[model samples]
Target chain A: MPNCRTVVPFSGTPEQEQKLREVIARYKGTQGPLMPILHEAQDIYGYLPEEVQATISEELDIPLAEIYGVSTFYSRFSLNPKGEVKVSVCLGTACYVKGAADVLAEVEAQLGCKAGSVTSDGKFSIDADRCVGACGLAPIMIVNGDVYGHMTVDRVAGILDSYRGEVE
Target chain B: MSENMINLKIDGVSVEVPAGSTVLQAALAAGVRIPTLCYMKDANELGSCRICVVEIKGGRGLAAACVYPAADGMEVFTNTEKVRASRRQTLELILSNHRMECPTCERNGDCELRRLAADMGIDSIRYEVEDLEPQLDESAPHLVRDNSKCILCRRCVAVCRKNQQVGVISAADRGFATHIESAFGRGLGEVSCVYCGQCVAACPTGALTLKRSIDAVRAAIDDPSKHVVVVPAPAVRVGLGDRFGMPVGESVQGKMVAALRRLGFDKVFDVDWAADVTIMEEGTELVGRIKAGEKMPMFTSCCPGWIKYMEHYHADMLDNLSSCRSPQQMMGGLVKTYYAEREGIAPEDIVVVSIMPCTAKKFEVSREEQRLENGCMPVDYSLTTRELSDMIAGAGIMFGLLPDEAFDPVLGDSTGAAVIFGASGGVMEAALRTAAVVLAGDDADVPLVFEDVRGMEGVKEAEYEVGGVKLRTCTVSGLANAEKVIRAMEAGEAAYDFIEVMACPGGCVNGAGQPMHSPFERMMTDVKGERAAGLYALDDSMPRRRSHENPEVKALYAEYLGEPCGHKAHHILHTEYVPRDTYNV
Candidate 1:
């Protein structure tokens, strides 16, 4: 796929780097530690930045190319920073047939960012999920924890509005 | 006959292969041909391309012969109508995404995909897809990546990761969008790539290719003001003939020189002379270290790829690397300095072009340190064996019919030790031939042939006593083997006084720039070994077998450079290395 996700600048703290080193040390020699370590790293930094990947590669002696390959193959792994308010539009066959593309377009227009990328302000991000196991709720739009089913082009802004300008 | 053997029927022919043999192996043993795309013998058997599919009697579906195991009493039909259709459909699907401009491709005549398509009677791509915008990555000095032509066979990826242990490229994304890329899609120059060109060698299509220096060399030759000189690496002699359809091991040294002379070179020198010079300097360094009992394990510095690898990955061991410049650069240094001064020509006016059986030499000649004291680079241009052949073809020269010719005077003559430098364990052997004599005071009984370290093995180790001093040495080709030796040294599990590391497996004879061989040819014969044998035979036939005994090199030292590793020689023939950040980002 063309890399549509804009590269979010690395703003990780020294504490995060230290925590990652400790986690890598813990799982250094264990079996198949890449996935678990990457999981914990994503939890710590909310993304897999080049700096983080370089650290993991050096610590584990694994090629960064392989790590990046794995990071890009799975959908759960993000190479960019997560937005303060996560917005997901299910683009599964059931939902896509129900005008989910229009709903996704509306969200992109409102957030000023394409799917798989964070907003410039870091307040919102749009993700086109394959399936959230909510085909019954065709054309579903989920913002944070609230699932807005039977979503339309007009409802995208309202759903995204509830989480906008809110401090974490 | 053997307990581990299994019997199977392939294309109605009874075959007996090992129990764990794949269907592909069974078919080959049964004299049946099963076409494959992504299968590269032991290196890669991914079976991602279903072109090698075959039908099994009483089986549910057709299975990929490359990955399918051959069971006892199994009946396989490789030419079934269903299997043929599946192979054709798979080829068509693969061709759909590929940009089909084969006329201008480097692999036009030898592309595996095109050959397969033609074999299967596929006249056209039935399911052509819209071509994606072409991604051309020419960021590195040695090679280029044209993603538009990549078939995603992963042969390059497999070679890079498994054989070289420099996993710089891998498959990224999923399905239709999947493509091979370096980490985070950075250019190869931005990563820790040694630029060995193994990827280009492994690639079955024109997706990867050598960054050509033929045009630049031609430009220099065409410039009347520039006095262009050419030198072919030792391996180039053995490797060049393959490009012209000669046998793999055929040595075309004399004809190669004739071709170069015909191409309008002011002088056609030899890198072998420089190799002899390298032994003088590197051997001195090794002996000095051994006598002082410091930096016990000294690594050979002849390979540019190995040097870059050491600079990027094993920076801690930088002290252990020999400070001698590679033979190519040494030849360049001498041509621009010694030859220029002797002939009353300006160093700036002399353009030294080296024809090498390697891509890394292209990068090597461009190093800032490779520049001479007069601010002129030793080698102006470095072209690969393939590029040399292309130049000869472009000039309309019938290479096979060319007359044998001799190299020019002064720096052209070399010894047998220098000629053998084309093979994997050759540098060590060459150095030993000279160093043993020096250590034993030139009168002691020292064996000339160190047979223990001679072969195509990944790693070879031997111990010998010279001048009553026990010397432990290790020779390794392929970076993966080098890594194992280094890791062992770091863990205190192994120790050595001298080490030779060549990045390409089987050394320059099988260098990435040598020639493109069909996958079938590569699997059926030991091409590298045959080329190495040619070098060994040439070495055996030479009048002088020791580097120290080279009359021309002796004259060079006596007249110009003075002593081995002396003040003047060190200044011109040696260089230093600095650690580089693995990821440029």
Candidate 2:
């Protein structure tokens, strides 16, 4: 968990909170609705804060233990907030063999953050993916849902700078 | 619904079991033994451990006999070379990762994993352990969790979730990184745990165990300045003998008192005396609630686990809980007060040690309300039957060879109703024995044996008319069932005059701190029923079967307490409940 001093206070609006509650209300009595509720919760809030999790726990009458367990199990769920420009580098078998590790390292260096960490300004974040199904574009990267195939270590700085400039 | 029986052959012997029964059940009926680690009869059927694997003809591979259902004319080979080899390999694999500190382990002799290894002739482990860092969670007062000895069988998880309805324990992380833990790196003490110790009982190894108080108890025993009086709950008599190699559910009452006397207790008293006293307070409260017609379904507050559960989860229904202290706590408080006054010993000089068939009593002793005005704990050291047995063995007392003896007089006299407090629905039955007379007249025509509340149903409900008042009652064992009934009551569905809840499935006899039943004992025998029979038999033979009829109890009220619900009784015998946080904040 990020320290309280560093974590941005929950600035989610009433509409967002209402939307989250509606998502929970829709799946109220469904057997094991935690997964779907969490999905919509992530959509409305962008990430799960302690308060959001607590709200779900109270609303669904489910133990926080079960909710936290399900949240931490899957890789898709993010407890931390996503950055304005999210970067993904595919580390699938083909890309890994094509030197995706070096590409990820260069990308991490440019962002000044490790994989799965958001930059302090909240403008950029880095993550390594298992497969983007772009093995033919072995050593691929994506920024803001736009694919940048056939990436290289030397080209990492300019690519990060381009997203950083755009977000700022 | 004709009794459907399916025939199968195991080890060349014909076996017939009810349809939908597992092959393990069929093999058991055929008198063939199959070793199991993760299987706890009705509670756990995960079959994660492959120790119970058996060769099924024409099957793809050796099937886990615990989960595989028996089919007509199916041939099962339990002890063939291939089956034995597979079972042996599974044991060896478990042994490779398990910390083999058997000699010094808490469950050295009784551990199922160690026993299976020996039975399968696992001479050596061929694989190396990864040396996972052991996390010893002694944060809770009653239980300790050691990851070193855990085999990851998930039996503790099942018991906590399925039986207790408290899923604080779950598989965290995955695979080699996986272990049973509370939510978000919290200790059991940090969660809403009632410290019932059911998971400790369900554990096959030393991974989970009672946080032993043997050394502290021994120090108190050795100090001549301290007067350490010992009280044994009635359930201990039926359970203690099993540790001494006697038959399960055998009442060793006289022998147990003798054993305690030999262990150097200043006075060996009976908690049954206090149990009788509990009936007086709880029964009066029930009658009072019925008279008021509020909090109609008065809940029995004897089981500390059930009490804490309600305090945490069902705070809204806290009014329904009886203000009476449990028999164990009542005994402790009275020993410090009334018994101290009678013997002319200063209350501070007396150290009350209780031998119980419960783990929750250890936590109950330290409950803030049970303490005295001087902040002295009423019960100084609450030891489990296992802990007491260990103490006896440590003191080199030959329990079986000792001659039978009687408890010390003043606090020892008890009626038969007191003894049955060890069984499920026993408190309700015991209270009814006295409540009938109190409600009607002295010679109220109430049946002695209430077969309605007898036996091991999860919840048993009954109604009777006493003095033209219809008494509706229900007895629930196991927290899951208790939760269900409480939820129903919240919905205005279940209405009754009295309700009893015991945290363990069959009450104190099946308590988590009691002896772990062997696989055969777990499968074939009604261990709960047998122990209950011993108490019921004592009730049948005793001169007085009702709590109110006990001459000693009458003398106690006359000499000290004055009356059942009097000020003195309320001060010493009653306690208030508090609403607790549902989650660790």
Candidate 3:
């Protein structure tokens, strides 16, 4: 394996640099330590791409398989870069029974993007999860951090329209 | 009393629980039974089942009490009007897509979902029922998958992937159309699933159920011309009582035999009889192979899950597997061949039924190689411990009130060592019992119980000094642990003289044929682990547990088979494996 070093100067504030250093130092000297650091980094930066995975893998001397395994094992970890706004629909049993299927279809139709895929404009990404434990609020959707419960097919376009407007 | 206790208030009740406790645990500690469908303690906590949603003050929405961390000075209301209304609505919605055939469902009485619905007073579902059709995938011999019954709790997925480490099934598709499916929508039998039935045990509802052979067995029993024989597996003795509400680990072997008799079987025999026969054959094979230097570390061939896994992943190591039939198959073969000749009955006239703690044995019984005797499969029907209990109940036989009876002579008697095979590492221990005695040239007075290889631990290893020879042995119960053991062996990190592997955790007591529950309390501290402990206790109490001491086995070798690895034994007992695609592509 060839060792390549590329130094990228940081222009963040001292506090930000200290936080990054603290996160990096937590995974030092452990076997296959890159995943934990990458997870923490993603917690700070939102999503990890190939560049982030490679940087952490190089720093921790862990194999790609080990990092990939950890990343894939956890539901929270995202490999592909996500858009600025995240739209998650709850496909819980309640939501499913309450016609979340049509709601999801409407969201997909309006955004022109499948769940777990980013929109063409890169403004939003849609992801479907098992449950957020809010089954009482059936057919629920979360945009950015605000949850929209009791969602309908007509409501989906309006929900995404608000995000598009905010981004603009 | 000062061991880092955390005080939390649940529904106005101030409860003190140990720190690091989840809000669910605290509520449970305070005698609040928060209804949940997908929160089996330790086994699964994926929060896929939203039935246990509770109102946490200032917390984000309703939280799944099973996984959410309970903080100090937290106000948690488990059963407020808001919580009850929400839970009722959630239950109603879940029922909208679910098949409400509880009257005819196998898990009707014991189902967690049914119990929860009744407890929550959900008399009817107000939502419009969807046109969701139940997919009854019955291609596998051991189990059936009904997608309509599934709540998508991911309990089955978690147990399959994390516990068993066999990723044959997972949540496929997305949104409301999402369903748990085998890879590429292939049948489970087509996938590299070992048929251990751990997924069945983990499922909260009627989504996964054992493929029952009770009807077949009943038909055979009713056949006037056929002599129906029952072979109870090693672990069945310990768990047969759980179906009757008997305390876990209580030996219901006698009652099991009685039940079989009541169910109109001609003979009720012990599978342990053949387990002893297996030890004799496998133990002797190991010795001969070791002496000839043909193959070292001969694997036990009893667990069908381990056998199937080896057939799929380690085909090259097939030579290392002992060519000995499992006790179930051995007994089946013996009943059809040796016993048939003695009774002056045709082999076709004998209906061999095996009652086992494993669902994998259902697949094992149906295997083509198992038909070595008279061109017929040795075991005609393989029923699970739960199935046997149901049959007993169906017959209206008073299990507890019935007198304790003995197994019929010739095949009913089994040694104490054979009983342990019901748990993980039991096969290795049973083999060691015979192997060590044979290696010592005579049955020595040394303790036969290999304590190191016993327990609920995922993996156990022990090195024994037997008559100047150091024999390294290892036992792994769960599939994930089995994967770890195989990886270790491949990496040369661990070397063993023998290895025993079972596909389910805590062995056959937790097999797919066992009870299914979600939001299952901690097995160790709850009812499930108690049943497992019951199995271990039965093994400890049995007298003459060693396989060599079974008179039936001794007589079979003396009258029919010359020795353990004789030509007659080899022709009838041993089997081979076939390779499978791991990726299911």
lDDT tens digits, residues A133-161, model 1? 88988999888868989998987777677
Candidates 1 and 3, the one with greater lDDT = 1
Question: B192-231 in candidate 3: lDDT tens per residue?
Answer: 7888888887776788888887888888878899989888
Q: Extract clashing residue pairs from model 2.
A: none
Model 1, span B71-183: residue lDDT tens: 99999999989999999999898888787788988888678888998999998778757676667999999988989889899999999999999999998888777889898
- List the DockQ of the predictions in order: 0.55, 0.23, 0.03
Per-model TM-score (chain A alone) = 0.79, 0.79, 0.68
**Local accuracy by lDDT, each model:** 0.89, 0.85, 0.77
Candidate of highest lDDT: 1
Residue by residue across B202-228, what tens digits does model 2's lDDT show? 888989989889899889989999999
Which pairs of residues collide in model 1? Answer: none
For candidate 3, what is the DockQ-based docking class? incorrect
Better of 2 and 3 by DockQ: 2
Candidate 1: stretches off by over 4 Å:
A1-6, A85-87, A98-114, A119-121, A132-168
* Per-residue C-alpha lDDT of model 2 across residues A8-90, encoded as one tens digit per residue: 45677899999998998999999989999999898888777657877898898776666666665666666557788999888
